[model samples]
Target: MNKSMNVFVIIALVMLSGCFPSNDLEKKQVHLTGITMGTVAYNIKYIEQPIDGGTPIPSDVVVHQNVERILKQLNQDMSNWIPDSELSKFNSHDSLSPVKISEGLRRVIAESIRLGHLSEGKLDVTIGPLINLWGFGPEARPEKAPTQEEIAQAQARTGIDNLMLEGNMLTKRIPNLYVDLSTIAKGYAVDLVAEYLDSISAHNYLVEIGGELRAKGFKHTGELWSVAIEKPVSTERAVHQIIIPKDNAIATSGDYRKYFEENGQRYSHIIDPDTGKPINHKLVSVTVIHPSSMTADGLSTAMMLMGPEKAYAFAEEHKIAAYLISKSENGFIEQFTVEFMPYLK
Candidate 1:
């Protein structure tokens, strides 16, 4: 096993001392490889079922390489911007013919659109035009803030409602609407990595991508993996941590991560679909934990756009656990739902 995996295994054993049936353990790290939609990494750790000691290094190294390859394919194959990508071709043709798509692409898009509707169109995949108009991502940077007219035009062409799913084929209701899957692609990739780990009988593992995390079973120490929530603006460290003990996924969305500075002002990439403008909420970050990574992933963005108060209320109404860190008039304020408070370890 690699040094890092060794350390995690030690931690897991210590945590499991009281919970697990036996002290003898065989820990192995598997580094999976493969790239499908974008960039992804799976840090998987598994305990030998019969306590049979085994090598952890070579197996882990191979797994890592496999995961990388999968992510690469996903990025190229599903990108909507690429005219030859599966997604773009599906959108280009107006016909409702059943088109076969990569299972990964189909699953992610279906989940994204489902979450968009569940959030009342708060988390939209068709915000690409608006995202580009605002100079985010690969879209050209606007020299200055776009006029209200320009913003409205982009907004008119963007919406989750514009997506039409017929049989195995996907078509856009709006002629020029383009779909951007960035919001949920990372989480979907994490989900795929988790599936692969399970297929290999790797039970204790945690997968993370760009900050989104999904942990199953226990950490190397035998205790639940403790993931820290980074303070907004402080990428080097986490302000709080959540200990994972069960099968759950967590995703945090904030304006601090992706932004551009111009004329002494910082503009975030997160845009409010309803307003057709960037979100100016005082929230620093929002962490959402739920059963599905897709839901946890998209809800975090929606919560950021909804602001603290509304976000909190939404979480409460849906019985979802959420942790919101906001910029108060004085300093920072942290709020959590009743269900989420317990995870604030």
Candidate 2:
């Protein structure tokens, strides 16, 4: 899937997850570049402060090359949409044969399944049909919303329980079940890229793919990464910003993007699994910051589905920092969990 295809609605607005600025320093530097991986174009920045004649880090070519290799493998292995990809072949053949897969693919699939279970099936990978039926992807849409009977049939085939994983192999228990990793794939890929950069002993870096981002050590000037939280309306402006240090990930999920209007009603891309319809709630967007990219990605989506009040409670209970933008008759109301208040400055 082309990253461009994903409207910069929620997650993309927080791409600057890490942006540290040097304070009381004489020297300043920044490295800005872009790299294309799979179907997404990532904007990468490498900032470093020379420490008493410290040698410069590796060139941008090296970083791009490494990211390319990882992304290529991920795109090929984890993609169920591709006919010859490992997942596609497995789902197509419906065979229990143990297919060997790369470590990255294995980890991605495992984490996805775990999220599906932990979220009580709220975040499901077997929602490909739902996504397509609602015209969230490349599929055509019907002139009207899916009938109750059609939605029920799609809902029956969608669930985490339909997936069976044993060691390196995976098989679909339901014949029509198709897995779409759009919810977390980009975030996972960003983390993988960050890990590779860390492996090379490189710090002070920020990487963004389709607006999902991960930070390394610090900015070249030694300030936390500064990212903007977008207002949850149909505008291209950001109303607030958050600064985060290393070892944290942020993801946003909302319905402001990729929505269609029919009969004077708006239908968003976020599907309501229970009703097999686009979610219609008070929330416009939810941004989540966590220690893990996978957690950040999944929780953002789950909270979007859980609505405002429950999402606040859930975040508070989990000790997660969250910022939610909701729609009201007066305008947009901004709310945040207590955990995120410390970073409000």
Q: List candidate 1 stretches off by more than 4 Å.
A: 1-21, 30-58, 80-83, 91-100, 234-236
What's the TM-score of every candidate structure? 0.84, 0.85
Q: What local lDDT does model 1 show for residue 167?
A: 49
**RMSD to native for every prediction?**
6.6, 5.8
Provide the lowest-lDDT 10-residue window in model 1. Answer: 1-10
Q: Model 2 over residues 1-345: C-alpha lDDT tens digits?
A: 001112233442332433334343333444544544345677666654443446565666666777778777777877755678776765566554455766766777788888777667778878877888887754687788777888887788788888877787776776767777778887887788777766665655677777677766555545556676666667665454454535677788888867999899898988877678888889778888776666678778878877877777777887778888777776666778777776554
lDDT of 1 by residue, 128-164 (tens): 8889898885657989888899999989888898886
Q: Model 1: number of clashes?
A: 40
lDDT agreement with native, every candidate = 0.70, 0.70
As a TM-score, model 2 comes out at: 0.85
